[model samples]
Structures are given as C-alpha cells and as structure tokens.
Target: MRKTGAVPVISGAWALPNAPQFSEGIAKAKELCRSAGGTFAVLNVEGEDEQSQSVLETAFRDARSDEWKEFLADCLKFEAEIAKEISIEKFTFAELEEEEQSLERLRRWFRDLKKRDALQLPAAEQAQKALNSCIDSLEAYAQSVYSAQNGGE
Candidate 1:
C-alpha cells in the first residue's frame, strides 16, 4: 500500500463483549499499518450490530458534535495503547485468502444492511473510505508478494 504514495488509515471497531484476542487483533492490524506506513485507529463502541450505525455516524460525521469528537479522541488514545502491544509477525499467504473472504463478507453485509427499511447511515461514505484502504492495501500487498516471488523484476 505504501508504494502508491497514498496514505492509508487502518481502522476497526472493538465492539462490546470483546473476545480475549480483540486487543491482539487490533495490535496486529496496527502493526501492519506501521510496517506499511499508515495510520492506525479503532472505534471502541458497544454492540456490533446494525443498530450501532447511529453511534458510528455521529463519530464519523463531517461536523461531528463536540461530545462525539471528544469520545473519538479518547478512543484514539485507547487504540494507541493497544497498538503498543503489537508483536511483529509474518503476513502469511493464508491471510491474503482470509482478507479476500472478508471483502466478500463485507459485500454481503452491506447488501443486507441496505435491504432494511430504516437504514440511516448518512455518513456511510466515511465508512467506505476505510474499505477502499483495505482494497488498496490488498492489491499493494499482492503486488509486493508477486514481485518478491519474481526476484524483484
């Protein structure tokens, strides 16, 4: 992703009832951003369901309310602490397949989400920014891997 000269922001949500690996997962993702030269952030919010859109919208809006901005600032600090625990690891080929699968899952998720009668994510575009980063990162990573295999031709 760094090869493109475009900055990538790696972000994800740490929803309620978090698993034991949540911190590790976030830290690992942060490490990826670090190695690739990008920003790392997380949204620590409750509930990992469609009902959480309003909360995300408030946080992601262009002119976010002061309260939400402060909340996001706190989340950033928390994410920074989590990032401190990052343990460097190899990016396996299997993980690339997993990332592709996640992209398909994301597609299904958004399709189902739009089928709802009360879809209210006005800042949905803001969310798309993150997805675009993932796509760009995936392509860049694949390119780098291929180049390595080809002896850096």
Candidate 2:
C-alpha cells in the first residue's frame, strides 16, 4: 500500500555487529522510501498494534508524551534479539515460500480480528511473528533470486 505522504521508517535496532546484516537484508527498504519520496529512519518499533498503543496512550496522555518514544526504544532491543535468532541469510528457498504462505494466513487472521476486539495477546503476538517471518523469508528469497538470475556474483 502506498502510504499517502507517509515516510518509511526501519523500526528495529541497527547497531550491534549483526545489525548491519539485518539492514542489508532490507536494503530495498531505503529504496522503497526513495521511490516514494519519503524519509527513512532506522528506529526501533515497539507496541505497533492497538493494545500497546493503548498502554502508551494511558501511560502518557499529554500531548507531548514521551511514552511512545520509550516504546520505540524497547522495540529496538527486541529487534536485536530477534535478529540474533534469525539472520538475513538463514532462510532457504522453500522456507521463504513457506513464510510467504504464513504471511498470507496472518493477513487473513488480522482481517478477521477487525470484527473482534477481544482477541488474546497470544494471537496478536503470533500475527507479528508471522509478519516478521515473511519479511525475512522474502529478503532471503530476493537475494537468492537476484543472484541466480545474474549468474551469481
């Protein structure tokens, strides 16, 4: 979806040794931003969903609340951990396809969630995992596909 005047932000940590690898995986992320003529920042993303957003809103209801900023900082730490568990080059072609399929399932699940506001935290967490898995898979797949099509550099 083309965000209307929306900038691209790479939410997650990018300072550790393996951080560069994660960023490299999503190199197109910057390209995506450029194509859309938007800004890009490699920041951590925490509480991206409604529940977390609510917590933030409640914690600091002030117009200039910094709770959201703090949440993003926490998210960066979490992203670093996730990156340790799964690197950019880890997925295979088959796994990439599986991740893609899983993402589709998540999309359907999230859509269903629209009608139900009482969804459990676990379900929401699972959806997030699926989304991340799909991103990693696609990144690996793109790398492989590009290399193969170019006869491997």
Candidate 3:
C-alpha cells in the first residue's frame, strides 16, 4: 500500500442504495495508489436482488482476464518500506514494563499495513511472517515472565 511499484486492484460489494459510498471508497483507494506512484483498478459490485449474481459473474470474468492477471503480477512487486523501518530485534520483550508497548507497536505497524491494503505484496507477506514470529517470541517471553512472577500459577 505504500506505493511499492505495483498495480493494485480494489474490489468491493455494495447494495444499490450505498453505491455512492462504495464509489467514494474506490476513488479514495485509487488516489492512495496514485500518490504512492502506482496504478489501480476497481471492481465494484452493486445490487441486492438476483441481478447481483450477474454483476458478480461479470466481475469474476473481468478478474480472470489477462489484464487482471498482469495487474496482480505487477502488484506482487510492491515493496513495503515499513519492513525496513522496523526491526524485530528492537522489541526484544526483555523488560516486563516494555513488553506491552513493544507488542502494541508491532500490532500497530501490522494494522497500518493491512489498512493500507499492502498485504497482497510478497514483501508485505514476508513482513507479516516476520511480525508473527516476533509476536510469538514476545508472547512466549511474556508467559515466562508471568510464570516467574506468579510461581508458575
């Protein structure tokens, strides 16, 4: 989502009544991609009745097109800068007082990437894997600390 050299495809579903908001979301997403120096396409499915199925089918067809495939391939190249900005080792979970803050920061970073829709990139996925590993280590450290403080209760 940080404009890593990729084309992002934003998809959404909305009832006919909320079409305006759905369109706005797509527009905003497009702008975000553009600001990041990338291109974006949108697939907005609208309707609540049987027509909805047809709309979705058409969307599916478009999604399966060669153009969409190229778009996805392009998106895979996105490189998230946060992956380099935050080092997992920096949050070692060594002190009980700092453990919560460390976890919160890691979670916030992860959530920000997700909100920015960067999870689709391979780099983002790698970052997520690293983040999960750090979270696991931190949780284990917290457990050990708790056990030590509470006599393993």
lDDT (0 to 1) per candidate: 0.43, 0.43, 0.45
lDDT digits (tens) for residues 107-144 of candidate 1: 55444332221223443443345445555656665565
Candidate 3 lDDT:
0.45
Q: Which ranges of candidate 2 are over 4 A from the true structure?
A: 1-102, 114-120
**Clashing residue pairs found in predicted model 2:** none
Per-candidate clash tally? 0, 0, 0
Each prediction's RMSD over C-alphas, in Å, is: 18.0, 17.5, 11.8
Could you estimate the TM-score for every candidate? 0.37, 0.29, 0.37
- Considering summed lDDT, which 10 consecutive residues are worst modelled in model 1? 1-10
Residue-level error in angstroms, candidate 3, position 132: 1.1
Q: Candidate 2: minimum summed lDDT over ten consecutive residues — where?
A: 1-10
As for candidate 3, its clashing pairs are none
Tens-digit lDDT string for candidate 2 (74-116) = 3444445335425654434565455456455545544443222
Against the correct fold, how does model 2 do in TM-score?
0.29
Residue-by-residue lDDT tens digits, candidate 3, 102-140: 556656655544433322445456556666665665565
